[model samples]
Target: MPNCNAHDPYTQVASISIADYDYPLPESRIAQAPCAPRDAAKLLVDGPSRPIDAHFSHLNDYLPPASPLVVNDSKVIHARLAMQRSSGGRFELFLLEPIEPASYEAMFAARGPVRWHCLMGRAQRWRDDTALTLGSHPDETLRARRIPPHTGGEGIVELSWATGETFAELLDRLGQIPIPPYLGRCATADDNQWYQTVYARHEGSVAAPTAGLHLTAPLLRTLEDAGHPILHTTLHVGAGTFLPVKGDSIGAHPMHSERTVITRRLLQGLLAASAPVVAVGTTSMRTLESLYWLGAQLIDSQGPAALHLPQWTPYQTDRTPPTAESLQALLKRMDTLRVDTLEASTSLIIAPGYTFHVANALITNFHQPRSTLLLLVAALIGARWRALYDHALRGDYRFLSYGDGMILFNRNCKKA
Candidate 1:
């Protein structure tokens, strides 16, 4: 009794709901701590042909000999803060995103316009709105003012600083890095380094690009020495990545939008390179695929009569078929003029029906059940995800960010 249109198989699989993606994970398997030396973790290479088990230190062996590896260079910021109220009440603040410099608000369950909102904590005694003071520094003093709430259960707070310095500086002086809740541990001194990727460049993401966390400078040098190229893209990992799909069907769940930037030079390299393009993490894969779709749209519009003559009338068209190179040049020119370079917010949920325009192979960490990450994995390898997960679980391969990784090659890859 399911609708089975030839064009849409998703609607036909009634029993294959979001719940089907759920698997029983033991509490003990959760990696509360990361492996030392970062690259000392495990790696499980699962492909359509065979499964290879190895340590993370031997990662370079699995990559395509000389293929370029695209990496997400977004750096995690210290966003969590602690406050104490005059009433002797303590509240924990987990900074989601920046709204202002020194004085910004966060998600809290309290009603008032006062100087503080109480966050839920141990015992029922701490759940009351009380005057609180933040910052241990002598020059820093934060007074929180309650504001209107927003969607997704987030509440606003107005912050007033005692000093004239920008809010960012105050945060850097006081806030702690917000680690994942599952870690069940406070952000210690070691997290400042271990939680970050060796190639992290852009500084805005709240969460570390877990897949990139496996890459070290030595591995990168080895890749470069082997004639493989490495490109960097930015995708600020948002707190929403930790949220699970609560809907019955994966299609019914709404995906969160994340800001991403893919440079024109990187796009051109991907299009021109004869070597395969391997995405370092799912975040990088999303950025590449999103940009490729945008580029493809431009390519489709550059036909004989479809060209926007005003933008490219100065250039001559050769007899040779038009290529992505020319389009990339035009995009660069636009960028120099302060125009957007294929920039846009993407909520591109890569479920089964989505077609991949970029990325040949993916190096990623094992993901949680009923998560969007798993859907992406399923989309990449068809039914191989189940087998891969089962194999990893049985073989003692770690799971989740800070856990083991798998290098997956798309069987449906065009070149394959």
Candidate 2:
């Protein structure tokens, strides 16, 4: 692939290998169930300044009191489907992302026509050219026909549903929320709601924005009443969220592209707000950083509808120079056009040596070891991630999506 001048700075940064981000997480620490009344969960506040243990309910105390809190409102759908082969052998089908309309023989795995792969279960048993039918007919019908194969042992599965009935409607009836295998249980009635965040609105993601799951309606109301600005962006979480980096060097790892959207109004709000920007989850953080690097200005509304930022692409632009004001202006113009949102694909992976263009603080949950989430946490706080993980291990912070939360304030921003 040819390199773009816009990505030069990113290319110059020293890449951190996947091994540096690995940590020791006990199997017992992974939470199988959510804390009753989500906000009641624990929170571990760690930084170079000080490390403190607290409950998620006290999240406001760590904030600046009036800073803008940006969150990803992308909702998780029941993307997991159970299908039987011709021999009556059951296999699992997890929807990664939407490639085409639910009714028009849509594509899966990654969007676009060229790469339409999806992760399939029982790979050893299922042949390369297997087909699985989903849903009952008369009202609506859906089927998944396997196409060619791809790396990581996944293959393309073309989906088709009945006409007049939208894909969303078909999924509502035939699909199950594609929870991580680490959850160690079958989907239940509670999963339909517990797996999703209270603020979830956009319906495109296959995985839940776990960090946002800790927030409750009361907590949001409190933040709003306290004069803190809140804005939302959407990034449809894909199967890539769970793919582990296999290569020793970050460069060798294949970055998966996921769809993201940032509205002009949300951008304007971030620029105009007197307080610093705090991201609610990693998805929101990625969207803000990607947009900020794209020379997105309130004035660039008419130029393009969506922006694509691949992981290997540099996050800075010479014309833009990566500034908060410029990003805010870009978002403001989007808002003015009532283009509150812009959709694009991102393969950008945040790690150490990468400079953050947006978000001063983050509210996230602890992630699994050897996962991209762990690498992101390490990048946010430098080497302190190791020490923090050690602290959590000793202090009993539940690990993974349903576990405890953390409020990470970037030390680099403080020094700057």
lDDT leader: 2
lDDT of 2 by residue, 1-416 (tens): 63445446554433456777787777899998889899989888874577899887888887886899998998888888787666678887776655444311242222322223467887667766666666555345455677654555476677665455556666777889877788888888888888999988878788899998899999999888888887988888887888887777666667688877667667678767676788998888887777765554333444455566667555343354446655755655555667555566788778766677678888888887777777777778888888878888898889888888888988776211
Report the CA-based lDDT of candidate 1 relative to the real structure: 0.67
* Cα-based lDDT at residue 335, candidate 2: 58
Q: How close to the true structure is residue 248 of candidate 2, measured as C-alpha lDDT?
A: 71
lDDT of 2: 0.73
Residue clash pairs of candidate 1: 85-132, 101-167, 102-167
Q: Lowest-lDDT window of 10 residues in candidate 2?
A: 107-116
* Candidate 1 segments exceeding 4 Å error: 1-16, 100-132, 149-152, 162-166, 296-343
